[model samples]
Target: MQIPAGPLLQTINSPEDLKKVPKEKLHQVCDELRQYIIDVVSVHGGHFAASLGVVELTVALHYIYNTPYDQLVWDVGHQAYGHKILTGRRDNFISNRKYKGLSGFPKRSESEYDSFGVGHSSTSISAALGMAMAAKYKGETDRKAVAVIGDGAMTAGMAFEALNHAGVADTDMLVILNDNCMSIDPNVGALKEYLTDITTSQTYNKLRDDVWKMLGKLPVGKNFTREMASKLEAGIKGMVTRSSNLFEALNMRYFGPIDGHNITKLVDTLKDLRNIPGPKLLHIVTVKGKGYELAEKDQTKWHAPGLFDKITGEIYKKKFDLPQPPKYQDVFGHTILELAEKNEKVMGITPAMPSGSSLNIMMKAMPHRAIDVGIAEQHAVTLSAGMATQGLKVFCNIYSSFMQRAYDQAVHDAAIQKLPVIFCLDRAGLVGEDGPTHHGAYDVPYFRCIPNMIISAPMNEAELRNLMYTAQLDSTNLPFVIRYPRGEGVMPEWRRPLEEIKLGTGRRLREGKDVAILSFGHPGNFAAAAIRELRAEGIEPAHYDMRFAKPLDEALLHEALLQYEKIITVEDGTVVGGFGSAVAEFMALHGYKNDLKILGIPDRIVEHGTLKELHRECGYDAQAIADAVRQMRKQPVSEMTIPA
Candidate 1:
């Protein structure tokens, strides 16, 4: 079905073209843009509500500014769909988040208008400040830099750190706070409350507005100079808002708690702010899913409601014939709640990803015990460590890619202290469609080298449950990591009785004579499928599920090594310093000469695509694993000997 854009939207091929449109027609453009987004995303899936919320702002920014020249940096990229469409990507918008198609986020390589690439939150201010500083250094006085950041993004410490620096840097830049009070989930923390007070305070707004009008009416002669007018306005703002004016305190001029959905207001505001000298901020209040009635009501559910019916608002789902296997995240969610019930010590924590990580299951049932720590990964880790000191079992669930931000905290606060914090790493492998920034490829390698860290991966739902059970037991002392993939696990009947898995151990799934295949995590299922395929070819290979990456199961390694001379290691993470590398290091340490092949994500940036596509591209899918086994069968196996 061809979804036609609004007549006005079709005419806008670029920001230059947008500037050509009459200012009176921008509201129509915003409406058309919002409807077009709904039409396209309802068929071709990507992030939904965020872009819808920013439609007016997107149109206004392009219409008012000389973009590409006046750079606009969108924080988190969820709101950049309209920006992309206006800036020469309108026709290809249907390919958003598809394999070899448009990226879901704002990528500099994708277009000149995308001033900076962003996927992770709270980075726009720093990036825009850098651009502003560069422009200043080059004496480009006419160039302007604007960072459009959400209130949810403002919760991160990095955002404040950038604000602290940009305030004193004296660079000419604008930070537009899109405060819809959301970041995938509803915004939390003191900042949310502070922004709320600023938005809702009628007394302050009235005083400020009255003073602005009074100043405008004042004479511009020697009696009331422009500088005098500016000083008067500053004094009134500081007095009216009192200590609540955070941006003013930071030495940046503050403007607005205005309706972001007002196209004309946004256009006028941006035009005026473009000429304002030094640092400044504009606070715009808009609904997250503006213009879409259903999306407006439930912002979180519509955040990325993949492939919905735009008319009926029915989200599409694969109709399974029977009960399907649960997602790894759901299993984690339910399991953590069960663990919390059985053990009073267990508490849950996630950094603004309760829904994504499935911690909302626990948070709903056990509100006091579970916490959503608003986009602060480092703080989440350290907070978990603090709870551990009180003998509480903390399940700090975070996305694999997001965990990178908390590495220092994990090392210093948890690992060094030997705090038994259970880190449930969701989306641990090639998370389809989200692309490079979101892949969970490095956790295995990065955490393996940390002292006292027990890094493990589960082959399926049962193992995941068992691992969770074992990690929370009184016997387990060190920091534990349970990394799993993005989507569904293999077992449909996943609700199994929990059992304690032994630490630093592995189980041989199959016994063979010709070769051995050792796998870590959910990739073990791929290995199983490959083994089934190879069996028909008479290639009898042994299979072992090596559960732990940090603590090598020497007994299992010895058993496999003593029996087979040809070995293959598979994982869902980067091959370098990953599970395969750990196995290789063990072999080298024991002086075992085996013809080995390492198969997993390669040491490179894998782009956005389906899991199957990325897995095949990375050469670790079932077919790839089968091919590796077949290739090894043709070669003569080197004789293996144990070290004296």
Candidate 2:
């Protein structure tokens, strides 16, 4: 139980240093790295179990491959912490997933070793393929390309697509399928069964190896002998295993259901494969939470543990520091549970974000009413649409960025059919630490353009709760979307009780004469703060919180135009086709001569940083808004400062 100090981890600063260490000392380094991860994550919560599971895999890959020069892409990037520690990031691991610190996922900008950034699931194969193909095109044959994807990530269709392409291209690439037999939840589908079949094949490997050895002794030409060996291996594998030869069928060599935790086995197998020709797949069987007994015992809860006692491995609980109610998502969970209690037709669905969306509470309260549909966002959307047709009130909760995956489903199935399904989009803004891929910056723009969809952004938890209730009870015969930001809701003394706000209407939070600022969703609160700051400068700017994005608040907007010469629109989503664009489009059509400015997310992929940093970068923060307005008033049209 004694913790090792300093120089053990210090000497191993990078992968090169790791290579110099004797093989015998690897277990010691892994032990230290695992304990170090546990210590840091206990204080600053993050994806724990995943990193722990891949300790040896990380070590093996770094030991075998020339990383940074050779490309290593980690799918979903949640399990790359161990890799990070081995690749010169151990010192910064303490600040992992925290505000203004290291990201939870692999970031290309963070280090040279992280060849491709990934936050979404199933991107490793495609990214690795790209790097491999690029390497081939550039004639860089000396470098290796590797993709480490999870068994859960393998379920995604994109992963299969990459596999199919990689197999046919005959590119020199290595795909390590880390089969832990779980996603956030237990994996589902025919593919999962196929993998189970492959992993459980008792005699397939034995017969194939025996046949290869026999073929090795044949007195034939080298090319013919190699082709015959491959064919014989396939024929023997087919006879013994009825499961589809997915990778082999696509023309890639397949290896293992090997022991993923066995560092020696992993390193040896990788070393052998390094000399092999063409595309290859290595299926490594790993446990999700490999080391810590508590994490191993309850993999799901420990997937991302909060501050916990190292001895008992139990999370440390504390009372809330604020007098405010629970988060908007938490409130939605409670509300849905209550609604389901009365209406048996109610069902809750989430696309692999049960905990983040607060659907876990509902799942616990009424297991039948709530369901986790894995990482299939598109499937979840249409599935909800299917349930709605049966007269069921389906509440589909997903993160704002994730809902992008279901765009076609939203348009084709739900909106087109006008199903009464409630799409609750959580984290609908610049999510901190997780960065660009995880940001909820594009949902408003993406969803606003779709027909038969009513999108609303609530300012506080009470409003969010009411919106959910309203969406459920509305006989409008259309799909409804309620988007909210991550974390706690704003505290206000004059908070109103839950009530249905009229569709397409906006409430004037503050009345002023010179200018009007129209804000949507979470940014509305910041707009109000900016207004107060403007007032101190004798600029009494008006503030209006638009509840609905789709409806456009034409009446309120028209009224504002009549009273004010200058207008600004602010939202948390992209300005391209979002609330600002909606306002600008309306003003232009109406031939309003007033000068206008729009504020929202920019039209580029942002990187890993805190929400505050992103907002400041995008000019969505309160001080940024105040400065933008002040600058706009003082300068001409060409000289006015506008968000990029």
Q: Please tell me which predicted candidate would have the highest lDDT against the true structure.
A: 1
The residue ranges of model 2 lying beyond 4 angstroms of the native Cα positions read 1-8, 94-101, 200-244, 306-322, 365-369, 389-391, 416-421, 491-498, 529-541, 603-605, 624-644
Candidate 2 lDDT, 1-644, residue by residue in tens: 22332466778889999899788777887787778878778777788899888988998899989998989999988899988888888777777876567878888778888898888998899989998999999999887899999988887667888999998876899999998878776776677788888888888867766776787688789656666776777787788885336878877788877889888888889999888868999989988888899988888788877789878887987677756556767777777887788778889998777777878888998988898877778889999999999999999999988888778889999988889889998888888777778889888878888888899998877777677767877465689999998776775332445576677788888888667889998788888888888888898888888889888888898888777777888898888889888888887778776778889888887665667778888888999888877876775543222212
Each prediction's number of clashing residue pairs: 0, 0
The residue-by-residue lDDT of candidate 1 on 388-458, one tens digit each, is: 99999999999999999999999999999999999999999899999988999999999999999999999
Clashing pairs in 2: none
Q: After superposition, how far is residue 637 of candidate 2 from its true place, in Å?
A: 13
What lDDT score is found at residue 87 in candidate 1? Answer: 90
> After TM-score superposition, what is the CA distance of residue 95 in candidate 2 from its true location, in Å?
4.7
